[model samples]
Target: MSLPPDIADLLAPKYGLDPSICTGPGLVAATRLRMEINGLDDEFSYYDQLRQSGEELDAFVEELLIPESWFFRDRVPFDFLKSWVTESWLPTAKPEVDVLRVLSLPCAAGQEPYSIAITLLEAGLRPEQFSILSGDLSPRFVEQAREGTYRSIAFRGEDYVEREKYFEDIGEGLIRVRSFVRNLVSFKSMNLVCAEDYADDGPFQLIFCRNVLIYFNDDARRMAFEGLERSLTDDGVLFAGHADAIFRINDDFGRYGPPGAFCYSRRAKSETEDVPDALPKPQSKPLPAIEKRRRFFQTSKVAELPKSKDPVRLPSADSLTEAKRLADSGQLEDAERICRERIDTGPASADACFLLGEILLARKEVADADAQFRRTVYLDKSHRDALFRLALLAEQRGDSREAGNWRRRAANRAQPSTSMTNSPST
Candidate 1:
């Protein structure tokens, strides 16, 4: 239950993760899996392997880090960028100014940074007028972002006008960002807490780091905030998630611009204030894990997720296969319709619900996706992939006990579900 304190302490310094952020059991479970995969039986052996193998450590960090991201995720921040650039940035700036620099931390699969490009372009900012520096802790995520490929799930708002204007459909469910947008970003793999890893060439006018601070412990939070502060110009604005109010957490930054912008500007020396006595350390209050799992766009060995438990009067096998293809190919709506029709006709179609759940998730409708995954589980108690997804979601959201409970159930379910091993989880 205590989750091997040694491992907990070991990870914080290396990866800058709080036990509360990864949640104790996910780290332990992942570590155990890492050990077993590497042929190490004991924790000591695994620890030794970790010291000898940088790859192993990378693999471990990959498991614990959730790289969920979407284009225009939450929508408001992109709108804020558009407003700031057109109104404040463009108006008061000199025509001879360098590219209006911006940063997107934890830019999962390039969505946020790409979205920023789209917003600026839509607002008539020429490609040469702005530059986006995108970074993420996960090398896998950084690589994916550089690829510039995405799916319907990455498109948060239903409107496809932007997609049509800025992206080229690459078949199935994949969308590739156009060259103009892709050219605007410079992607790098960097950790937030490692000040050394930060680009010395910063002072970005705006930084979009939504939902990242809430994942850090207080020390790590301070480190990350300090890094951001150092990276920004005095007038630079930080666009954070609404849930983690900067003023409430740290007084070094003051509210900037609109009240609901979730934006902050560095405070002058005289403006510094103290935190309330009642507010707990951020490490103790890590945000709930509504974050998406690191989904590798269908190329990995683990891409094909599990099949449903048991089904009655299910859709034709061909139809289900077609549905998978549709979802994978990027025809999410068609895939959803087919899955729903199957479920409506066959109420106990766990496979249909499972398929639908994956589609919803791909569309970035997380709460709906969560519901569908739960439905798949209810219909088929032994649905390991669904259980694991739920478990990961629970863990990320700060419900450590629930996360552990679901994880245990998932582990138990795994032994018997060998046939679905290559099916989706991460």
Candidate 2:
């Protein structure tokens, strides 16, 4: 059986889980299994117990949101961390301020924050020169993070080299992080959707929130980013997952470097921050159910998103190529319009659908983009780009099985004639 609608509705406000994850069969089976293990009579009983019992709720969230991560899970972020500290942070270090504060929100057991600690040390900073705060929604995860023990699977590639220096072999393929590394970090349980919980923990110089926001629905994302924005210092850099570009809607930050950097710095205060496309219109109609529920949890009203610039008509060209050009130029609405027109006027084209999907993603309309990509694959099963996109979207939403299936399909369809040899591993 699937997660019940009432239980799913409780998730976003209570635990910050995206309701869309409920549509997958994995969560359904997991919830049913949990209920049986708990000896609950029915879904309603499970819901009642969850609401009344904090332990049960935490356990349920843990079971549903099982994390998959490792030391230096993505090497780019850690490499950038070391570079940023060496090039950017050290030059401006204040004589009176000896300690650099960093945070890894939803630190996912302990790897990410520990990775940050190790990177800072590698950058020649002593443990006393920096402090790290890590948090996750799961109490179990927080406790495990505090324990600082991991199986060999937590080390990937050359990561074991660092592990050897910092971790003691505890036998049975387990390793424990040394006291020096563990001393630099403090771990706790937190729900990012509750912005007020960490309101005073602010002004972190560097925040690593990678691969996190993609799991939240729109309102939850806004709430979480609000907290992140408030917590970061004016000159601080925020490193996030490439897929977590939803924060761009607020304009409080600007891309710090190249697109692949996945890093952002707060825009200067003199610049106006605009919210665009994510807000609802005047109440001529009822708001979406998710929007209505979202509004109920907000402590203040959010500004309406700014309207897009008017599309300038251009000379007709090859429709697909023109759309690509427009999208590349950041004229997303115009690109989207061309793609839609092609779909509406001509026979269904997988290329058009795929391009439309890309346009929607650029606009941060994730659900719509997912639908378009699904349509593209339906039209042409061998469309590798669409398959790859579906895999990423599935993984972002915590559907590992679907992600693996889509990735395998994408690999099978890779063309031998293409110059690219092997696909990059995530």
Candidate 3:
């Protein structure tokens, strides 16, 4: 099913989404689901509702938002982040700019920003020596990030022993990022596509916008890159996703450090000369000045979501552990039983729902498994593992749009932290 062209037109320019991406089957189904859930009887009514209600529009966009991320996902960048701070940034930082300021745009559910804090700490910078600002387009993600709690699934790198020291294991397979790391970072809800939202935040020394920008069409991509350039200091470093292909945007930045690092430094006459021949250097003419930024998303485009005062409760840790052990030991029935019992006796448990979903999948109850995964997300929006499973389920059922949505959601929550093998040098 194709999304209404009018709706696509409404969303694409506002959020910087590729118009074509809005036409996916999964997205179409999700759109209809939103319409149904909101009591709209037809697409026309849905479009009208969206036009009239910013909260409804945000909900529709939230369905498409990807928040996939995990801690220290791709290790090379963190290694480079630490090195750049200690070896490069510190030596030349002006006395007036004493504190190292970093920004992580689209920080997902806080994994990337927290990872930055940990890297800075590991680099011997005291918490007071550096500050981090993490932002995402989704308010739900920003709130989740501020909570500083996550499932163990959020950690995927081999440095488990080292990273473990910075987390305290809360019950039910969850961990809370230590206060020392959490204190160094501030979280905010922001739309980077809106230049006004971005203009006030930076001139940052280092910026990590990794794994974003691949979702934009040409116009949005250009605008996004220009915004990043405007926010970066003259000599500051900017890290991008490998697939972002920022080199194609313009010669404004030259590759910094090694290839897979996907980092760029503002192109100055001397700096451009050091860039590899693969990226042709610009002529010696002075770079053009930045234009005044434009603001696309306006005040009327947003409405506050009502806050819930209820506290969340999860299944006991021992119950979750036993369920995992039973499932691993080939006793899926017992595991499923324990999960259901937990759900019945306690407040909704995302952990229990996720585990039951896994068990159902193992039992080949695909439809039931999908429902359980959905339930897990309903309980905890930032459950990366559940989102991943939902994506896999969608893909297996040949619903590419649904799979893409789920994958993007999971991808945003996970940071790509490990070194890329056999990647080309920039």
Candidate 4:
């Protein structure tokens, strides 16, 4: 009993989990299971050909593991961690406290754990004072971490001075992490999803598990969070993806964020005695005329465009177009300022409103962009651009039905107006 040739080829080199381990009727089942676990679709067209080439299989596995990450990714989270540790966690530590353990589970090729090491070093902690446990499921990634060498291109256009201070040029366009930073981190191969993988080496103080849980289903997320809770100390904090929220998942953790990123801390025993209100309540008021107009567009099929009044003194249409051009060129803050000034003078200008929404969307201010799009639609129900953008936002939030509806409405409104010619009366 032999496995499918393609399936065997795909799993052999990349996972080092031999497909030949299964025999007889179990081969197909094992192959399908491997595909599912690796998040590969069952119907890959090139599955047959790809299996024969170890290179192709390795490339596919590489794609699955190489998630988007960078040096000091999401800077706000690091800043918050630094302040929280110095102002809150460190002060609470006893003078004789021998070790402060921080873990970066599934640390990938080590960018995140290394970033944590640099942060601790910058905060005046010596390598001996703290230990970073960096673990990953991939043996290849673990080996790479141990090597601590990276292509200079990985630095991108980052500050050259910081790179010089932290990295030793290892030649051939590779730079090695300084020993001081490298020494703080211990690389190990551990599968986070396994129950009995690593011994109880922690009551870890901080765990950076960013961007890993987004791939998980709800059940897997619950299991991962439970594992994290068990691994953490009473006062431990867990940092997740910037876009991910765990507030609805468990009451055991409290969510906090500065300006850009959100994190969770295990709820303290004292918190049970005095539960703080999590969200602010909005004061009730009657909807303004503009808001009412916006709501009407949202709920009603009738298109009602706002009438222009007295040629309102607004920025030239050129300025609005210029702002968009600037924004597309990556001058975001500048574009936002220009659009905001135009909006201040002529609040009903849908073009300006839409431009502002584009800038806000680029900045990841989804809620703000949603409001601006609503306003743009209110001022000009035929604003197809705003409707399309709003539809995209809906799609991003997983509201496919609403997204389709909005897109249909936008398409209807964007249709070319009919023109008529009549013969003169005889």
Candidate 5:
């Protein structure tokens, strides 16, 4: 019952479900039962495999639906959510209408919805004033959400303290959520891609759909957007992944705050007129020279180059060498500043760009780091350090294919330099 290669390829991109799960011995009986139920022929094509095999299809669906989330996964988005609820949404609510509904679709084992509940509770919303509707396609996750149990390993950083405060020891390395937060949320099994079942719960004021859309293809993304649009109130706010943007995907939404962050709002009539009909114009000035120097030391590689012609420029080699010295001496911010200053003086310095990317990546400014890496590569394709860093960033973002491509390019470029040294002709 081996699947055709083309079918596997098509399915692979959409869902990271391991194909071996289907070919495995344990699933054979289940697979056969599924095929028979759907009246699929033995000689059926790849699409038929998807239609016929319930077990395999379930595995695929699970991949698309699961998301990695933790309590307060990204603080900024939660902070904004808290502020908006306290200052905006709550004030606007009619006093006569006591129930404030919040829905976390695909709640993914309950961390997000619980986080929302905690925020509301902290904001002084009484138990009756607010309600959390948490849903997911996985019955297992839904059950876990109901139990509100978590292992110590699932709690990280500040979450460790929060977990201890909000949960009671239930034995066996599990902790049960306290009554206060638990009472705020109601768990249900839901498939967000199919929204009819939840139509009665419509028009949420705020929807936390973060980090879920990255799994979907364009059409699925569109469908999800439409579903959200239908489910949201007119002034409702939707929060998506830090890296995700609706600007390119949907005209119905508008971006807010600085670029490349989770802050966005529903498109306003006046805002729509302000959006340029074309791509945003590029920035006029080069990044600061100090920032370039900061970036250079972070990577610890000098771009191969004709050095800058400016005589007043900080001693080029010494500047980088000193920046590295400062970095090793535990002066990270200082080293970064030096790199930035170096880049501002001249745009051709890929060394500065690579260093800046490294510093930014270290600081957890991933999007900014990614931009610096792109700049480094654009300036010098042979920049191995930039290529390596870009590969690492891509891998972190769950894009292994892009990671592999960058790694291969780096390896190929590194090879030629090594090969030339061993040649006798030189």
Candidate 6:
């Protein structure tokens, strides 16, 4: 049996939430909660309230969107992404001024975008050379993505060592993203259904819309694909979910790799006729330049991080503070230069090496940055960022054993380091 027509119609069009899969009891339970909150007992009354108030609908949408994402959820696409960036992307890029723009729509609780940032970092692209723009239909998820923190469950299948690399265990099992990875990604609230949301934003180098299309009806899927097509650059690639391979539907994209990978490259427009959409497309135009948000998403900008009163602090920090300031201020060259100077003037410094590694990362210099990060861990075995970067580098290169080893090492070091002072014979 299907949902009552009104509820089904209301949900399907706006959010592409298929009634068939979402099932019955789940909808009833969720709707019941809304009814209780609004003091409406009847289903139709609640549906009326949903129709009358936009806020209620948004909240309902949030309830419907269960974000089930993990870093590199299925490893193949990222492996493909790493290969594409190195083999296809970098060679064609104007690295000096043209930043590699990537978009992750529905950046639920931020895993995908953060994964993108970390993956790109692992690939050794400098922060300045790439920028990740993440958006979600739920403002709440968008805010969460901005904060860049996660619980241990977020890293469940992953090695603990890998977790130690990008996150700091503030307390409990919660972890916060390091500034290096966080800096590369920007989060915004967007409705993929509303074509206006992304009209002005991109013709991105890469776009990830994984696992979302499964919920959409045929027409909604077509609309989503069309919108993606609009934002994707002629040479850009789209990363999709495995279960719903995009190749089955569209003539617009040529399958880039093996089945289950879900990566596709846009066909030359001339080679393919404009793919027909069941639904009418939204008219898109550029928005005013002034409306664009240029500032980095700090705690205040979006402010929905899982709050920790007692944050864990690591030692061996020095010019990194200033270097970070320079980098954030867009003085990347100066940041790199000063970090190098710090390394030169200092005694075998792991902090400086890590900083240089980060600087090199923002520059998209992967191999060099990998070397620096490796040296960092050598100089100071407890350097978590370096350890994590090494893991990412290994993972990208398909070295699961090395990645696992580094992850294990990072996990070991994440525990509070104990100090032993030399004393006169006890």
lDDT of 2 by residue, 46-68 (tens): 87887787788768878887777
lDDT of each: 0.66, 0.69, 0.70, 0.62, 0.61, 0.66
For residues 106-220, could you state the per-residue lDDT of candidate 4 as single tens digits?
7777878988888877776666768888888767888888788888655655552377778889788888888877878898888665524543666576788886654454556
Clash counts per candidate, in order, are: 13, 1, 25, 0, 25, 8
Sorting all predicted structures by TM-score, with the top scorer first, yields 2, 3, 1, 6, 5, 4
Which structure is stronger by TM-score: 2 or 6?
2
- Candidate 3: C-alpha lDDT: 0.70
- The regions of model 1 sitting more than 4 angstroms off are 1-3, 22-48, 257-260, 268-426
lDDT of candidate 2?
Answer: 0.69
Q: Which pairs, if any, clash in model 6?
A: 124-366, 125-364, 126-361, 126-362, 126-363, 126-364, 127-362, 161-407
lDDT of 1 by residue, 1-426 (tens): 334566667677766675554445456677778877888888788777766677877787787665667777766556666776776566655556556778888787888888888888877788777888887888888898899988777776586244678889999988899887788899988888875565464756778888666556668878887677667654567888743446546555554433235566644334223211111111112112211111221133322211223322335767777877777777888877777656533325667777777787767777667767766776678988788877877767676777788778888874442122233232
Q: Residue 195 error for model 4, in Å?
A: 4.5
lDDT (C-alpha) at residue 109 in model 4: 79
Candidate 3 per-residue lDDT over residues 45-87, each given as its tens digit:
7878888888888888877765568988767678877777776
- Indicate the residue-level lDDT of 103 in model 1: 82
Model 4 TM-score on a 0 to 1 scale: 0.55
Per-prediction TM-score, please? Answer: 0.61, 0.65, 0.63, 0.55, 0.59, 0.59
Regions more than 4 Å wrong, model 5: 1-52, 60-66, 159-165, 257-261, 269-426
Q: Which stretches of candidate 6 lie over 4 Å from their true place?
A: 36-45, 268-426
Error of 3 at 230 (Å): 1.3
| Tens-digit per-residue lDDT, 334-372, candidate 6 | 777666555532335676677677767767877667767
* Model 1 lowest lDDT segment of ten: 275-284
TM-score of 6: 0.59
Candidate 4 residue 81 C-alpha distance from true site, Å: 2.0
